[model samples]
Each structure stands twice: as structure tokens, then as C-alpha cells.
Target chain A: MASFRSSLPVYATTLDVVWHYAFRTICGAILVFLVAPILVIIPLSFNAESFFSFTSGMVSLKPEAYSLKWYRDIFTNGMGAPEAAFGWSWLVDSWRHGQWMLALRNSVVVGVASTLVATALGTLASVGLSRPEMPFRGLIMGLLISPMIVPIIITATGLFFFFSSVGLAQTYLGLILAHALLGTPFVVITVTATLTSFDRSLMRAAANLGASPLRAFFSVQAPLILPGVISGALFAFVTSFDEVVVVLFLAEPDQRTIPRQMWSGLREQVSPTILAVATILVLISLAMLGSLEMLRRRVERLKTETPI
Target chain B: MTAVELGTEGLERRLARAERRGKLRAFLLVAPLLAFVLLSFAMPILTLVRQAAYNTLVSANLPETTALIADWKVDAPVPEPLCEALVREMHAAKEVDPAIPSRIATFVNRERAGSLSRVKQVANADIKAPYCAGLAALHDDWAQPDIWRALKIVAPSFSPRFFLQALDFRLQADGSIRSQDSNEALHLMLFRRTLLVAAGVTLACALLGFPVAYLLAHVSLRVSNMLLIIVLLPFWTSLLVRTTAWIALLQQNGVVNDTLVALHIIGEKGRLEMMYNMFATLVVMTHVLLPFMILPLFSVMKGINPNFTRAALSLGATPSTAFWKVYFPQTIPGLGAGCLLVFILAVGYYITPALVGGQSGQLISNIIAFHMQKTLNWPLAAAIGTILLAGVLLLYWLYSRLVGIDKMKLG
Candidate 1:
């Protein structure tokens, strides 16, 4: 059976080459599959046509002929703004102008507010739990992480009821608090992981030299873990920004999030304006995530470069 | 408060005192979370549990009757006291809201299903005679078997009937628990299907991710880093955007079909079915979760020493055998971590499935959403939510036991 390999059309050299390349190509193709849908939205957003189809200009890769009509429609109602009923003028106008300036503004506000609150609380908890002698650290960690593990849908459902009962259901503060609660787990996990790499001896050395604990923490330890804290903060931002299900259950028309808006648009109607919005969101999220990743890599590098 | 600052105490003794202080500090740190959990999480759960039992719709609607009939027995007729209570309560309910009868009828009618005759018997009965007026003064026997059964079903202060209803089982006319629908299939089937879909998505992710992870791990760092960026790129986008992008690409007149038609894969006939189907759901879900699997596996594989396969090969094992026997086992923990994380995540996924899957692909969570939002069936939703929570906790417990969580990392 082994000797019969020579009878095949391909030689051993060919077989070895083909087999190795096949898996690599397959991997590359799978990666592309995972990413292409997101990438395609960029071009689709710029198409001159009213429909989802890529026109001849877009297909030929000629940027000059392509229209920013969608972008214009997104803002300033370039396509002659569709008349919105039921006081949904903001959504309709947003769809028309190809402009997400307001949504972006709202998202940033919500995301930043949530990130700050979540990160502060998470950092405090992580710091307090950082010491080895802390009692019930495991249980505290479990409770902190429970919000992350319990399905968001379940949490959203329960929170909707709870918030509604308390008369805070659709209020901005309620949504912000919910987002912060949801975003806290990411902050806690990332900060705790960062804390694991902190060299306590440096802090102890500083304290021994008559530096206050707070001073030592700021001057010595904070510098080392700042990257983690920043990355955690960014993670919190992303968590709040991209969150949909909970926001769907909680946010009102006045407090409509981009994701919730997108959900309504997709389900209620199909429009290219959503594609434009999506592409822009993709760009922003990519920027945020790229920086977060770079910071994390820096932390990793710092950990490795430091000597015992 | 440095331990060194303390006078006359030895280092270890001071350290122990510091340790005690640390414990106190930790308790103080977690006190807020404890309070939040007790008020937010614990109270909500308790409320959900409370909602699962006791028939309060009628009682809340007729407060006077509920108060008067607090000690009323099962076989007792409409006593004068209860009749007066019912009249006052009904009048009060009507005064508060003229729509109380329809609401009360909805509640009462829910209690009597498929036994309209039995329900009518109770509705028409009158026991007031000359003592009271209106409903009570009619002087007819209103007590019926179906009403009694409905009352009995709801009599328990903490009934598991919501759980049963959540599973699509309900108390039947004969008082035996049976399927809610005549089809005899429980909604557990939906939960099972959701699990199956989740499992399928996880399996797909693992299969597709393993090769990519292996390639990335074994490749040059420059190549691997580039590949890693490509893998990480998807995380930078919103899930809603990604899902909608698939719709743009997969819809009937969308890019995919347009390309396929151009390439002669199919005439326009096969386009419409692709977008709102199970295949689209599985594809989108697998795409979304692939990174989750690959990142963990890649990190684990990167940490694995390549010499194991070489070591096996030097001992005369075939290349395939060496790879299978030596290399694969080292990645089990990573595989388990990825599988667990991806499966658990995919099972709870709501939006992607709802947007793409439509009717056929809706999961248990979608149904839970429906009950909570649309139907206002909080008890049923809570029951399902509790079941799902239990399932997740059990899975986590199983996973922790099977592979120590401390050693496993999720990306």
C-alpha cells in the first residue's frame, strides 16, 4: 500500500506541498470569511445607488465616481428626508442624512459615563481584593463576575421589570447605571488580571522609605498597572457602546442607543443608511479595540522586561 | 499603616495583624456589592419566586372578597359575609376602572380552560338571596368543578406551576399535569433545540478554528502577528453591524446572490431562502463565535512546546501518530475552555438569531423575551430564566470539575 503511492498522478513532493498549503489556505479563507462581512459594509455604504447593490463605479474600484449620498442621507436628509410618523422624526432624519453625528454623540456620552463609573468601582474592588489576606475573595470575585456570566437577556428582562417597578425604566440615569453595572465585570476582570502582574515589593519598598500608601500607590504601582486600568476602561467603553439586548430592554425613545436604533431599523425596515452607520461604528470600534490591544501588549512587554 | 511603624511587635505578629486588617478592608470593599446584590439581585429573585405562585389576579382585583374569603374553605357556599365582600370589591374594582370585569374575566377564564360549561355554571350561580344585591342577590348555585380546580391549582402559596407552564405543561381538567398544547410536546423541546443549535455552532467554531489556531501557533511570529490582527479585527465591530452586514451580503438581491448568479452557481431561484434560514443563523453565529474559540486555542497552542511531536517522532512514531499522540493532548484544556465559553455564549444569543433566524431559529431566550415584553407573563419568563440560570450554573459546575477553571483562560 505504501509503495503504491508512486502509481498516483502526484509525486510525494507534490502531495507534501499540496497538503501543507491546503490547510494554510483554508485557514486564511476561514479568517477572511469571519471578517469579510464587516469589511463589505464599508464599500456598500458608499454606493451611489438607492439600493444595497454595488454600482459599476464601486465594483470597478473607482472612488471618484462613487457617491457620498448615503453619508449625506445619513445627515441633512440629502435624499429628501422621509416623513416620519409618531414623533420618530429623529430616527427618520438620521436615516436620511447618512449622518450619525448625534448617535455618535449619544453613544460617546453613554459609553464614557458607563466606563468611568464601572472602572472606578471595579478598580476599588480589585485593589481591596488584591491583598492575599483578603477574606472571601473567591466569593466576591464570583459575585462580581456573575453579571458577566448570567445571560444578558435574563439580566435585561429582570432589570426591565425591576427598573419599571422603581419608575426608572426608561430614564437616562437608569440606563447609564444599568450599562455601568453590565460594564463593571469587564473592568473588574481586566484590572484584577493586571493586579496579578504588579510587583508588591516595589510598593512595599516605597512605603518603607516613608512614602504614604497612597503616595506609593500613585508614584510606583499606578504607573505599572495604568495600562491595564486604561485597557479595562476601554473595554468598559466597548461593552457599553456595543451592547444591544440590555439597551433594547432599558432605553427609551429619548435615550435610544445606536445598537437599539439599528435593531429597530433592521427589523422594521431595510435601508442603506444602517449600513453607513454600521461601517462608521466598525471604524470607531476598530480604533478603540486596536488601542486597547496595543496597551495590553505594552503591559505584557512591561511584565516580561522587568527583572525579579 | 505600615507594619514596621507598629512598636514592640515582631514581624510575623505584625504581619498577622496586617492580615486581619486586610480582611477587614476586603469586607468593607465588598460591602457595597453585598448590599447591591441583596437589594437588586436577591430581591428580584425573591420577587420572581413570589410571582411564580399564588393566584393573586382575582384577589388583587377584588380586595374585599379576598380579605373576607381569607379563611373561606373549599366546600363553603357563598356565605353572607363573602357575598357582601364580593359586592363591595366588585363595585370598588368597577369604580377604580370600568374595565375590571374584562380583566377579571380574563383571569377567571384563564383558570377555566376547555370547560366553558363548568365555567358558565359558576358564573350563572347566585347565593345572595335576600341578604345582598346584584351578583349575590340572584340566588343560584355558582360553584363549579372547573373553577374549584383553577382555584386549587393556584391555592398554593408557592406553586411550581409557572415552572411547569414555562416548560409548556399545565394542569389539565382532570387535575393531572400535562402538555400545555394538545400536541403533547413540551416547550423543553425549544430549550433542547436551542442547546443543540448552540452545540452545533460551537462544534463548527472548533472545527474551523483549530486549523487556523494550529497554523498561527506554528507559523513565524511576523506571520502570526499579522494573522492575529486579522483574527482580532472582528472584535472591533458591533455584533448588530456584523449581523446586518450578513443580511446585506446574503439577502435575495444582495451581494452574495448577485455574485453567485454572476458566477453561474445558481439562477435567481435559490436566493430568497438563504437569508432567513437556519443556515444563515448558523453561519453568522459561527462567524461571531469563531474568534472566541480561535484566540483561546491559539494562546494555548503558542504556549505548548513544539518539541513534543519531534520527541515522539524521534522515538519512531509516524508523523501523524506523533502529532495525534503527542501534540493534541496538550491543547485539551484550551479546547475545553473554548468549547465551554463559546457554547454557553451561543446558547444565550438572542439578537442575531432573532434577526436572521426569524420564526424557525428563535431560541428559548427569544421566547422568554416574548413572554416578558409582549405577553407580560413575568412569572413564566422568570421561571424560564431561572431554569436557564440553573442550567448555566450546572454547566459551569460541571466544567469547573472536569477542567479546573483556574488553569483555563478565555479570550
Candidate 2:
């Protein structure tokens, strides 16, 4: 019964013990592979030097080896008169002139705009698709979701040709529409999932109690399925916020978004400012992941409390 | 009529009417998004495919030259009419738009490099009639037959030459198709590498994901939930953040090399070249895509009844035998779904490869981007995209068939 491998049973052969340990090692390595690259840059983003690598000072955990310079550079890089005293005017200057700030505003505007459009449409379609009476459900779902599955390059190429021909290329509206198209599937899937689990008898009960279809929906269906709608919107936001290829094809110099900015930063130059931005993005995603987990548990609780 | 009096047929008709009305209401709900997708998403893709077959680059700007060279022999001396058309087109190009000549220059310049200055010089010159003689007088390069041939190739509003170029085949002057000569294998090589990388990533994902997924599926609920977060957190993370992290970790003066040096495992001079090579591409991509492989496989593995494997273990079968013969077969659907999803994704991958995959790691998508942005060869770019799109959609179709896409999940 003496054993180094806790998971292996006493009757297991020597080969079983070896295989069991080896399996654990492989799984451990794979987990590390998944998580390490993401965690490795957190410390590096705070590097005192402009270099992407660690310094001896950093390795030795010297207090002076960490700095917030790159984080400041995100605001100061393209700001006019960045050396001016910090004030409301500095905030205004950053809003107007800072390159990364402009990209941040553009990303937020585009992400919110696209998420709103895609979520509205996707939720509506999902409602229809979830209806038992819906026709050609498979084919329509395929068409709606095809954008997510298609290689982004093909979509970008097509958009370049189509948008340029239609005079929509390089416009903010065009980029929003492109992102909305890409984000639609996520919204559709998530919202549809919540709707599929929704109990129909509650709607029937509301109707039986003299509630109008619209009123019943707003009161009964809306509250119960709200988590899916919100999660789907979040998904759409993240999809648009992280997207760059279509933006690269469609956006003009001024219409740059965060991902587009990071793309150029990575390609034209590998600067630590990008690492700083990435660190912020990682924090945002972590927050989103936490909220999604909570929403998921909420949905599960609601499901269990509801009758069949 | 009362149901008892109406009988079966009437009842059936009434039910059908109610069903149709429900269907109408449902269709109305979806109609707006359907129209939007059809007009925007589907139409743009169609436009992209159309570009590969028909383009207006030459026919729009070089109308006169295109008309004049419609029937010109490639091997023969430059005709007077063709020269006059070129002169007239160049002369009128300024009035139409000053950039037209350069556009034409770029269109033909790609075919034969030196033809740009010849086109520009003739456009700038105030040469009088005896236009053919004037063209010859302007420069000896202008007298070349190859310039005329370049015009012939690009002149048409409709041509399959782009697709030909994409496939590493060229249309000869005599209207024959032939393979591009040696060293012109750039397109073919890219196609090969795209598929190879996709396949390799799929295989690597399978190897790495299988154990992790199995462990998640088999473990206690509390342990599995904790491990699942470790898997899903990365999925929620931004892709560029992750790629940058890899660069920081793998770069020569980065943490990994520094650690190796500190440990005396390798000398400072012996630091490995990892970032911007195929090694980085495969490793980074495998890391990025591992979650995709694991999630679907884990979902499938979770559904499997443990007793089936336990029964096999209790029987004559050894642990490995039980795994291979009984347990593995049941995970095929999940494995198939994960593999196809990863392969489809990997095939069209751009961001990871572009960032990590240096020159040796560049895929067809990068080349396509180059043509679209830098080279400005829209037709050829469209052709390559069409090829890549076709492959991806085929695998997607296979995925839908093998594992219904509705069954696809996200965490």
C-alpha cells in the first residue's frame, strides 16, 4: 500500500504507477503551458527598463527595478504638451490628443455600438429560433453563425472589396457593422441557450392570468432569461473589443481601436507600453470571467428552482 | 362549428392554420437579422469570390489601351494602333485622374518590373503623332514586346489569371496553362505550410488536451470545478496579451533564457532562438488553442458513464487495454469535434502566426494580407482567400455533420 502516487491503487502494477505519474506530469505541464504565458508578462510589464526582458535588478527583486513608466506612456505618448502640470486640462488633452486614449475611446465606442446591435438582433433571432414553430431553423442558424466560422481573412477581403465599392470603407459605421457581423454568433448562441432552458408554462400561466403577450414577456421571460442576454452582450463586447483584422482592413488612421493599436505595436515595434496595455486587458478579462461565472451559477440556480 | 360536428379533416385544417400563424410570427422575429446578414455578410463574401474572376483594375483605367490590345499578337512588334491607344490613354489619364497612370503602372509593373518608368515617361511626355515611333524614341524598354503582353494579361474585365497565379500556374501568351517554373513555388509552399501547421496543431492539441480533459471528467466535482477555471481563464484572456507574454518569455534576453543561464543549464552565448520561428509558432499556437480542444473533449468525457470503464477494468482487460478498447472509442465524438474545431481554426489563423511565426512561419493568410495591403493586388489576394475559405468551410461542414454545431459549447 506504500506509494508515492496517491491516485494509483495498491493493486496497480509498476507500469501503472509509472504511467500514472507520467500522466499527471503531462497534465501538469499542459496546465502550466496554458497559464504561464499569460502570467509571465505581468511582472515584465512593470520592468524599469525599456527592455522586454528581465533585468538583474528584477531577478534579484530589487525595489527600484519596477516602474509604471509604460503605463504612463499609454496616456502620454501622443498627448500634446504632456509635460504640462496634471489637471482637468491634462485629462481633456489626453481625451483629445493621446493616441492610445483615442484608440481606447474608439475601441469602447465601437465595442459598445457593435455589441448593442449584435445583441439586439441576436437575441431577437434566438427568440424566434427557440420557438417550436420556427421554420428552416437549421439553415437559418447556419447562415447566421457562418461569420464566426469563416476565416477572418476572407471576411476582411470581402469587406475591403464591398465596402470600398459602396463607399463605406474607412468609416466608423463600417467598422461597427463589420464587428457586429462577427459578434452576432456569440450572442445568438448564449441567448439561445438560456431561452432553450426557459419554461414555457410560465408564459402560459401569465396569459391565463389575462396578461398580454408583450406584458407577459417583459414580466416573466425577461427577468428569468436576463442572465443569458447580459452574458451574450458581454461576449459580443469582448469579441468586438479583441478583434483587429477587420479593423486593419477597414479603419483609417484615426479610427484605430485598442486591438488595432496593439497589432501595430506588436508588429512595427515590440514596446513595453503594449505589455502595459495587455496587463490592463488581462485585468478586464479577469473581471469579465468572474462576472460570467457568477451569472452562470445564477442561471443554474434559477434552472433548478424551476419546475419541469 | 363544434369539434364533434366538424370531424377530423376540419380539425386538422384548423390546427394547420394556427401552426402557420405561429411560424409567420417567428419568421418575422428573425427577418431583420436575416436581411442584415444576407446583405452584409453573404454579399461581401460573394463580392470577394467575384474579384478572383472579374476585376476592373485594367478595364476601368486603361480602357483605350485594353481595347486596342484586344487582339494584338504578343510576339509581334508593337502595333501603331496599340501605341496610339497607350499614348491617348496616358494623355487622357490626367484629365480622368492623375493617379490613373500610376494605377495602371502598378497593375502592369507587377508582371514586368521595369514597365513602370516606361508607362510614366510616356504619360509625362508631350510626344506628337507617329506614336509608335514616339514610344520607341522615348525608351528602348518601351519598344519591348513584353510590355504589350503585360497589357494583354491585365486588360480584360474578366480573367482567371489571378486564380491561376494563386495555384502556381500561369496562363501563357498563347492561351495555354502551365505550371510556374521552379522557384515560383511561393503560393504552393504557403498552401502546404498552412495545411501542415493546421494538422500539426490539431495533433498537438489532441495529445496535450486528452489527459487534462480526462482528468477533469473523472475527478471529484469540487476539484474539477477549480481546474476548469484554470482552463477557462485563459480562454477569457485577450489573444494579443497572450502572444506578447510568449514573446516576453521566449525572446533571447527574456525570462526563459535568463533562467537557464542562472541555472547553468546553458551558457549565455548558447541562448536558443525561439521567438519568430516555427518553434514559437507551434508552441504558442498549441498553447492558445489547447482550451478549444479540451473543452469539447471534456464535455464529452463527462457524459461517459464511469461504470463502463470500471466494468472493463474488472474483467480480463488490463488498464491500458480497457482504455484503448472501450473507453477511448466512446470519446471519439468529442475528440472528433475538438480536432475539427482546432483544425478549422488553425487553418485560418493569422494573429498568432503573424506575431510569433517569423518568415519561416508565415502562412497563406499573411501573404494574402501582403497582397491586399502592400502589393495592392486585390484579385490575387481574393484568389488565395477563396482557396483558404474553401478549405475551412469544407472542414466546418464536416464538423457540422460529425458533431452538430448546435452542440458546440463555450465556457
| Candidate 1 residue lDDT tens string, A1-308 | 45544544363566665677677689879988988889998988887776676666777888765778766555653324544442467566565453255556567788889888888877777777777767877666766766767788888877777777888788877777778887777777777788887887997899899999789988997788888788878878888888888778887765667787788889986788888888888888778767876896898799789775
lDDT of 2 by residue, B1-411 (tens): 777877887889999999999999999989989998997899999999998998786777668778878878777777888788888777787678888788888777867777888877878898878998888899877777887787788788888888999999987655778898778669999999989999999999999999999999988998998899899878988888888889889989888988899999999899999999999999988988999999999999999998998999888788779999999999999999999999998989998989989999898899999899887888899999998898888888888888986887787
TM-score for each model: 0.87, 0.94
**Residue A69 in model 2: lDDT:** 91
Q: Which stretches of candidate 2 lie over 4 Å from their true place?
A: A1-10, A13-15, A81-86, B1-10, B60-68, B73-94, B120-144
User: B-chain TM-score, every candidate?
Assistant: 0.81, 0.93
lDDT of 2 by residue, A1-308 (tens): 56485667777778878887888798888898888888878888899998888899998999899999999999998999899999999989988999999999999999999999999999889989999999999889888988989989889989989999999999999999999999999988888889989988888999999999899989999899899999999999999999989999999999999989999998898789999999999989989988998999999999888565
Q: What is the DockQ score, from 0 to 1, of model 2?
A: 0.76
Cα error of candidate 1 at position A79, Å: 12
Q: Which one is best on TM-score? A: 2
Q: lDDT at A51 for candidate 2?
A: 86
Q: Judging by DockQ against the true structure, name the best candidate.
A: 2
